[model samples]
Target: MKKIILPLMVVLFTACKEKNEKREVSFPEEKTVETPKDTLTKALEEEPALLSLDDVADTTFVRLRDYNRDFVYDMKYATDDNFLKTKVYDCAECYVRAKTAKALIAANEELMGQGYRIKFFDCYRPHDVQKKMWKIVPNPQYVADPAKGSIHNKGGAVDITLVDTDGNELEMGTGFDFFGKEAHHDYTGHPDEVLKNRKLLKETMEKHGFWSIRTEWWHYNLTSASNGKVANFRWDCE
Candidate 1:
């Protein structure tokens, strides 16, 4: 019995030692490797600089395309699709004063939260273009007098409508520049959908430092820009 007990004890000790050795071999001590920090720096360096209105002057005219790409454009005077039946503008471009652009961008941000965005039919009409439009229509209700100068000539007014995320235009009772009583804000002859659409546009614009005339539902002017001087600076088409 002594001889058998001694051999069993020896066997158990050997087995325990081997198990401990295996455990040590399975998991070696982890090394401290230095990670490269340049990866984050490289990523930031590769990113494009963001645009902002901070550096722009309030009176300076800015191309809206440079600041925001979400706004849609149909540039009426650039084509013969307007009441004039003549293309008076050399090109289709949306320009506005820096302050006006800031307001527009803010208004668009709010509208986007509601699944809508502003689509511009006209913006920042040059004084020369206003004169050309006057020559064609000569209607005070439709086009502002060149001598008096429009808010558009001052880079403050925009002819716009709302569109859903899918790009379908909201029904505003009439098309842009519709010269009739039906387009008036007081006109309640439209369907509920049209009235709601126009109300949304008017309320949103007015909330963002803009004011609308009673006669035109599409026209909105930045109240702060009303005092700006008329401009004739034409944007390059290219």
Candidate 2:
């Protein structure tokens, strides 16, 4: 009986020891993950749409200043500073066909890359203003015939010169609306720098789809814009 009781007690003590030594397995604690933010999408959501030629019609007239701010404006005919010595325009505003404006913006960008920008003397003359200019000059060589209509009346031409980044006009050997052989592209009597400047302006303009006439150094016509209609619609000054 003693041997049996001792064996039973030993078994019970062994089972109790095994139960006390046993431990449940534990895993690592979980951590919260954070997602990265998309900055480009956030910025695009906050920004407005940019102006583009795609938003405008090719033949539609657009205010040049509204589209580009790099150009400098003199608008000679808008004041008494031109050869006509008359302010024909109601105000000094530059407007051009959408196609012409696109070409000019491209040309001006190229010029700006070369440390120069286009300074406008005249742009998109009204048909009535063209008639007024013809009455003042009365010469086809000096002014375009209003009956036939100039490219300016058609919103395809710009009278421009090179200006530095500081807005100082480059010496092109002739002022805007200067009616003489000196303004002629073939005339080689000017200084080397003047010739170089004129060549830069001409070549750059021609490269951007403009053609210069033999009579005017400041004038350029957009080849693509030649087919546009003559416009007499005036811009309000207020």
Instruction: Give me the candidate number with maximum lDDT.
Output: 1
Candidate 1 local lDDT, residue 32:
97
Mind giving the per-residue lDDT tens digits that candidate 1 earns over 1-238? 9999999999999999999888844567799998877864575556555478899999999998777777888999899998888899998999999999999999999999999999999999999989998998898877889999999999999999999998899999899878899989999999999999999999999999999999999999999999999999889987
**Superposition TM-score, candidate 2 onto the true structure:** 0.78
- The best candidate by TM-score is 1
Residues 12-51, candidate 2: write the lDDT tens digits: 9999999878956789999989775587556555555546
TM-score of each: 0.79, 0.78
Q: Extract clashing residue pairs from model 2.
A: none
Q: Weakest 10 consecutive residues, lDDT, candidate 2?
A: 41-50
- Error at 189, model 2, angstroms: 1.0
Q: What would you estimate as the lDDT of candidate 2?
A: 0.89
